[model samples]
Target: MDLQRQIRNGWFFFLKHIFNPLTRRIARTSFGPFAIVRHVGRRSGKQYETPIIVSPAKDGFVIELTYGPDVDWHKNVLAANGCTVVWHGKEFAVDKPEPLDTETGRAAFPPPQQLVLNLLGRKHFEKLTCKKDE
Candidate 1:
């Protein structure tokens, strides 16, 4: 893994880190309530799960604004359109990803999540794109 990804993963999973759940509480719940997302990985096709604030995309839901490319989950969804997510313990289908331009496009998150991203980070990729996560 790359250095930045290593650092991010360590801080995220390690309970001792200050930026762990303590500092990132808002991120974990930034979207009012978490929405489960299921996507495969670019390198590994195994299913991965992540929770994030989401909003409507065309007719279906979108996690973040854009999908595709460097974001592993997005790429996975692009390669495989069908995903199953358990929400409230009920499984639901998430359509295959449809790519969007990161710049000059609608943010796919709801207002609450947009506020969270605006206060936290400015990266369009991070705010709009989904990553390979577990």
Candidate 2:
């Protein structure tokens, strides 16, 4: 494999209790009180799972993705349509991994990425290959 791909493959397979913990602080909200997820690399098919922030939606939950595109879980979320999630120590079926253009996520995210979210609205990220789909 190419050096970059080899390095990334080795690196991504192992996340820690520090980075991909069961719970982590997100903007001081202790957001795991809200959401979490379990997914894998889309192209590599390596297994991975982690906690994240989420909001209730219809019969499922909507995740405000922070890691941005090019990450495994984000790509996995899109591929699986509804990735497995655990919230507040409980598991739930998460559907529609939407990128919401909330005041916070929009402004905090990169300008180019924010524009895509603004244009796509919500629930479309699940179907996108990347932000370019918008």
Residue-level error in angstroms, candidate 1, position 86 = 3.2
Give the alpha carbon lDDT tens digit for every residue of 1-134 in model 1: 99999997886577345522342354344334345566777577577764544454544555553222465555666677656544345455765655444432236655666667667653343222332344
Angstrom error at residue 133, model 2: 30
lDDT tens digits, residue span 6-124, model 2: 88877655545345543444422434334556677777777766555454444555455545556666768778775666655555655545554466444544566557657866322
Q: For candidate 1, which ten residues in a row score worst on lDDT?
A: 122-131
Ten contiguous residues with the weakest lDDT in model 2:
125-134
TM-score versus the correct structure, for each prediction: 0.51, 0.49
Candidate lDDT (C-alpha), each: 0.51, 0.53
